[model samples]
Target: MSELKILIVDDDPVTRSMLKHTLNAHGYLTAEASDGADALAKMAAETFPIVISDWNMPNMNGLELCEQIRKHDSEGYIYTILLTSNNAMEDRVKGLRAGADDFIGKPFNKDELLERMAAGERVLNLETREALIFALAKLAESRDTDTGLHLERVQRYARFLTQELVGDPAFADEIDEEFIQLVYQTSPLHDIGKVGIPDSVLLHPGKLSKDQFKLMQSHTVIGADCLKGAIAKSPKAKFLHMAHDIARFHHEKFDGSGYPDGLVGEKIPLAARIVAIADVYDALRSRRIYKPAFSHERSCEIICGDAGSHFDPRLVAAFERVHEQFATIAERFSEPSELPGSAEPKELEMVH
Candidate 1:
């Protein structure tokens, strides 16, 4: 088992020391906080999956701490338990409403405390699902050798673009902290369907013929079907739903000129639209078998120039605002040989 760190928050030094000693004896690493405010400050500096907090504290109570933890924007879920003297049903309901995962009496038993922590561990372990998702995506990406760090670059690009739109009045209602995180997590799966493409077509050294190109375009549908099955199995998984949207519709164009299903304008999922620009930008900036990497300036010109036709104009405008950041992300992740070089703009075929 991995080292599990638990944060203990209580005003009483005796209680804190006792809990820490007990947890440490059971092979759990521990951190101490004097109160809820102190706990929040420590949490900002480090990740704590399980927090054992006393309900009464001077700076901030355990209830307020639970509420703040829910809003803290950490990457993983924090399983919080309230140590409270009040055993009333009303108090427990209040704790639940405040986001407390579990509760223990003020004089918590060693066995009961350990058992509660075990249950919290089970909940935190579910985060491994994210690791599984990324591994699966990487497996699919491994098939195409030319796209070095393509998934990483696209994930960053999609996240940066989504963050920029948070302030826009048009997307203010749609874009939020959760939506941005989901886009970052699921963007890498956009080309997962390409795994199904035949090696002959996917590994083609030169431009594909019309018939070959038609077959290549089917990757979008293929990837969507795979994710659709996953969604059916885990219908509540929001990340899979967004991944499904990106896989199915990232190739769809703004003006209904794209393949598989030519979804026009807003008909295309917003997540897919954001990913479309990210995918194309990486394609334009990365070296390919048939084309040298285009300079950042040239890539920007092509993407901005296609705003209304090939890409969403609003996203294009957002890209223009943060295009330099996009360049920085590409450079940060690119190998020395993959660095963009000056090349004349060419009428490139639709990037796979």
Candidate 2:
């Protein structure tokens, strides 16, 4: 019901102003771009729910901009409306083929345009809510510099494990598709508490001393507290509750030796247990400032060796069943190899 942010891209100043004022009068926040190139620039710098672009422009055409927006794999979806003076049916079909969502012919009707904009706003609201939720998980990934890609890779691995568990005789009855997805999406926040941990301990180049290690272990509690605070504000945030359990207990050991709360065996949350194995495996295989990366075979050996002690034996068995899936995730997000002092972050933008 609030104002929807809409971008108007047109080469003619008169047309752009008319559309902006018309849309703004209907309770929409407006942004304007003179050409397709400027529109793309705005698209990168900010988030817009819908783009109303003119077909003909100086640099790139509306169709080209539509194609570019389609290619970006990100959180929010951009509903594009191409403005064209051509009224031919073939031109409209071509525009749709080129990725235009809804086309408005030039000499557009104010009422028709408003109706289309309303529908686009409804679709965008759902996308915006989903984007906000995923953004929180991204924040967890941001805190741990060395744990880069752990949040991403583990989600894929968790999905695979959960999917398999849903078919297993022991877990099939309790594990449903919805439960699996919620766990997959929310599991990455398992280490969200690390945000509260000091960089001296988190970014230390070597193993932590006894006290430092104990202090480092408190991140689980901190993460849970932070997630609890968020849920306190919005009780409808069911995912946050799931994330709280995972964050608080992911470090717990199967043999009851892990930190914060030494939960044993099946006593720990299943979501936490699943993430624990995947986290450790990804951590061992990925490069970090403190330790060198280990090979897949060696990391697998360590995981299987510590099965009864470090992880739940049943979950470890589930992991072995989906080891290939883990390998795929690792290879997909694998860190580039670089010699000492020669590494640089591959110029990747903060997406979503």
- Predicted structure with the largest TM-score when compared to the true one: 1
RMSD of each: 8.4, 11.5
Runs in model 1 deviating more than 4 A are 1-127, 350-352
Global lDDT of each model?
Answer: 0.85, 0.74
Q: Tens digit of lDDT per residue, candidate 2, span 1-352?
A: 4477889999999999899888888788999999888988998898887999999998999988876675442345678899888768767656654556677878788998988888777656554544555677688567665666667677767766665564455664656544665776677677777778888887777656888878888989998998888899989876778889888988889999886788888888888888888778776676676556666776777789888998988888988877876776677676565111211222100000
My TM-score estimates for the predictions, one after another, are: 0.67, 0.59
In every candidate, how many clashes are there?
A: 0, 1
Span of 10 residues, lowest total lDDT, candidate 2:
343-352
